[model samples]
Target: MDVLSDVMTVLRTGRPFAARFAKSGPWSDHRIGRPNGFGVQLMVRGTAVAVTEGGETYKLGPGDALLVPHGAAHLVADSPDTPPGPRCEPGHAFPGAVLRSDDPEATHVILCLAYELAPNRNHPLIATLPDFVHIPADPGERPGLAGAIAMLDGELASEQRGGDTLVPALLDAVLMYLLRALLGPRTVECRFAGWATALADKAVGPALEAIHAAPARQWTVASLGEVAGLSRSAFAKRFTELVGQPPLAYLTSWRLTMAARLLADTEAPLASIARQVGYGSEFAFAAAFKRDFGTPPGQFRKQAPACDPGAEPFRREAVAV
Candidate 1:
């Protein structure tokens, strides 16, 4: 029932991101211009009736979810009786979806947030989804989702102490639930591996896990192949097929990602940081880091990449030995 928790899980596993919820007014019918970012809409309290291109109209209710693609224009209204007005183009992706209100009296609450997907790692599962995705309340299949939506509605209405924080988190959780519903059952290509058709293979899972677990682990094609339970050639072939990159290349990029995280979070000695990430010395780590990041770690950190606490990079996930 915690929407933010659910959304964060998807974000942690697939992308790094943040989310915030806001209140919107009941309008007759208003055209929403182009969106600059991607997001989902969760109708917590009041109905959000709308019509999109091709004159398609949707009646969103509580517990329903809509996905706006990178940038799409649409209309939203308090009721179908309202007429849609003009539209504007923001020149950026502002795609979105709809959420319905449960009670006519409850204030219309909309949850919106953006995520940063991995580089060259567009989640195929997400792409299969339509620009606008709607998740209707299913009592039998997804009671938790429904319950979470209701809880968010109540908390937002109450506006008690900590409501702002609690409400946004709940809304995030709902988005994650929706993502799982869309991705968990699907298998898709692994851009980091070329030998496999899908990244969801049990074998591929371990290899990916190991790479994410220790980016600087002196990984060799043979070693990664061992983890994947494939011969070197087979692993190379399959991994290249699934992930679309040589295993070593992916490992290097991950290492740089890890370094970026350390630079932003800790003021640890450069040598210590290098050793921690598997380099024998600071010089070696610096060389590799620069090769990958186009700048030395110290300089990059000085420039100060954005540090979002919620989207910390390369934090190791515990792996079963």
Candidate 2:
């Protein structure tokens, strides 16, 4: 699998949720958040302003999308001066309910998609991202979002055969298209570097894919360089410059992350887990795990929270909206 898809698969902690919301009149709403989740809000119609708790403000219009990878708290309103309205918490919204205002005139529509991610594991690829990724509909930058939104709304309303399975897949596709544009060659966000640049680089991209594909492989700097089709020293320099870590250092960190996920989500024995992450023995793996996680593997598993995807509804969390 590719780097983004692999990380997304390992990070998911619960099922995906999709909903469409309609609001009218002058309004401001602070939406609730999922503890370990990623959220994407696409402006379907009308205009609004987004104010993050960090004081970052965004003006949004039709076809624009905001991606909250770590569930940052934010408020959306008809205008910045609009009085902050009631908090938009869960259950306050029904499948197709209209969030009305003082006067039911002028409608603003938005499509919301959320993905529950694991709290225990943190991938550097995701860690390097900013709090929000805004893919504005800068003319040709993002196309066909309206069509995707219509399909999503229809799939949910119809609930025909296989809708349950199809809805999630559609949700994933919608997000993928938005993100694919984010990683496009023409993405000109000057502030985005590190992992984003490395992911798009021809040399570094292949090396990352190799590491994720086979974490247990006995990889040396020279071997990884060969995989990247670059000389050893050149690859080493470029990888560190773009990725912000030496190749082996990144490998060790990723190995520990994958090990932690296995510890929390699976019941495999310690020895088996050790070998899977490239440790020659259980004792060595335990030491590395403890160093990174501040707890031994056995204890971490014992203290692991209920991470089952069907465990329960999302707990309330906010960043500052």
Best by TM-score: 2
- Predicted candidate 1 versus true structure: per-residue lDDT over 21-43, tens digit per residue: 33345454333533333455566
User: For every model shown, what is its TM-score relative to the native structure?
Assistant: 0.64, 0.82
Candidate 1 vs. true structure, TM-score: 0.64
Q: Any idea how many clashes model 2 has?
A: 2
Candidate 1 regions with alpha-carbon error over 4 angstroms:
1-38, 45-61, 68-109, 115-139, 164-172, 185-199, 305-321
lDDT of 2: 0.73
48-112 per-residue lDDT for model 2 (tens digits): 88888877998888888888887777888888999887776433233212122121244776666
Angstrom error of the Cα, residue 44, model 2: value is: 1.4
Q: Which ranges in model 2 have alpha carbons more than 4 Å from their true place?
A: 32-37, 89-106, 138-147, 157-163, 185-191, 305-321
